[model samples]
Target chain A: MVSSFLSGLLGVWVIGVSTIDAFEFEDEVERLRYSGLIAEFRCPKCLNTNLSGSDAPVARDLRRTVYRLVDEGMTDDQVRRYLQARYGDFVLYDPPVRANTWILWFGPPFLLLAGILVLRRIGSRMTRVSLSDDERARLEVIRKQ
Target chain B: MKRAVFFAPFIGFIALVAILYAGFHLNDPSHLPSALVGQRFPGFELPELTSGKVLGHQTLLGEIRLVNVWATWCPTCLHEHTTLMDIRRATGLSIVGINYRDDGEKARRWLSLYGDPYDFTIVDANGDLGVELGVYGAPETFIVDADGIIRFRHVGDVNDGNWNREFLPILDSLTDG
Candidate 1:
């Protein structure tokens, strides 16, 4: 029974290894397009995971879609636009600077400006405080005493 | 000056908290926004489930219809079956089914057992159209207007609460128009 179980485990491992890398491309350009798209497109169902990396059903469906479109002679922009139209902007990792997402694009720069302003104000305040010569001499006298 | 600078972070924190608080109110987490809204339904040729007759965009053109993407494998579709039946009966609204990524025999059997609620069912065995529609999972429904434009999408099981809240209002307004 133990021997049979070990063989079963080995069989499962072999199948798993074979299945994950099963996708084939018709040509090099299609393969390149497929790989590039998979990295860029987000899986709608698995929010954080991209289409190529995710094993989620929706991701797999999207991958198949990308392959079909690429095979059908669609350009990279067309493929991206088609997906964006179907899945909305959420499916693209780098979403466009639209009304809804302008904050996302601008927020970091805005925060940086705010940070610089604060730092400059603090720096100025720090520079304003200096030891007078009299105070320095008094400190020297105290140290000597 | 130092105090004001220190207070800036606290003010920013409070502003963030307020924005987040407002965002929570604005967001309805249940609804997955449909990309097809305001756009015409994706054209497709599908074999009708019962008759195996080919139906395409022309079949869905005239009526304000509900296209439900469902399969036997999806548990929520089973739960939503009765609600679908009632919607058909009550409103007499045409509910078209897209049997997403499912076996034809299994889908037919499941529908017969559950009681067929759909006016017509489209067999999407390979889920080609489902991918085009960006269907994430089963039991996703779209409300298509008379002009073939997709008006709204409901992403999960259509229970009484959602029906009353979500589907009814749209139905009323569309009918009113």
Candidate 2:
């Protein structure tokens, strides 16, 4: 339990370092305000990039919309949920598990399971036999040492 | 299909990692682009919007300058115009605009209604100029140093808050020398 709590705090610190405040405004001159809000939580379809402007025009437009919403006072999570309401769970950058993202939610264990099953099936078989006198003597010597 | 399903979870894990890798690749949401940040500016010759005369890369050197990528068709650009005007007024920063993919009449009208804060405006009707500058959208902007290296890039409208918060400090840091 203590380990879990420590790690949770660590997670917050990590986010603090990685992401700047999405909505803090200073003056009215520079662009890129609220730029980090949405794409940080939104997913892209195929590109290696975030839902950020990638080669996909749609992704770029969605990011622009996110900037607009964040500037209009939507929190990062609120903007993500808004996309969820409109486009379902897949639109989320860090998507929640659902009927659609079953693959994402259950994928790791399934892989581990398959690996475990394959390993168990192919692993060295358990064999039972009375120990030979020589092996017993070797064990006795090792134990004594 | 069941085989695919049987392997789906592992594939999904691998794919998720790939997806995450890609997302982080674009993680900054274009606070900066992949190239040209802190790099020397590429050279270009553009016809001056007002005079139909050519201006080249050399003209941009020797001062802190702003390269604003904007369009009359973009309402967000309109939203940012006032903030940009205020910045221009305060700093006397050499301001330039790319009339991106826009008609001259509309560009002229936009400047009229919104007030042009730019010292130089160039026609980029086909976005060729924008392509060179790595512009992905209408309201993108960049801050270039006197050495012609790009110091900053903003991928959306510059509003009041961003001006006070991010830009001023960055510009101050850049110009402090």
| Winning model by DockQ | 1
Cand. 2: chain B TM-score: 0.80
User: TM-score of every model?
Assistant: 0.86, 0.52
**CAPRI level of candidate 1:** acceptable
lDDT minimum window of 10 residues, candidate 2 chain A: A23-32
Query: Candidate 1's residue-wise lDDT over B27-78, tens digit each?
Result: 6644456778888898999999989999998899889999999999999999
What is the i-RMS of every prediction? 2.3, 12.5
Off by over 4 Å in 2: A1-145, B1-32
Clashing pairs in 1: none
Query: Compared with the true structure, what per-residue lDDT tens digits does model 1 show for residues A1-145?
Result: 9988986786575444322535677865666667778878878887787787788777777888888888899999999999989988888889889898776687657666777888888888899988899999999999998
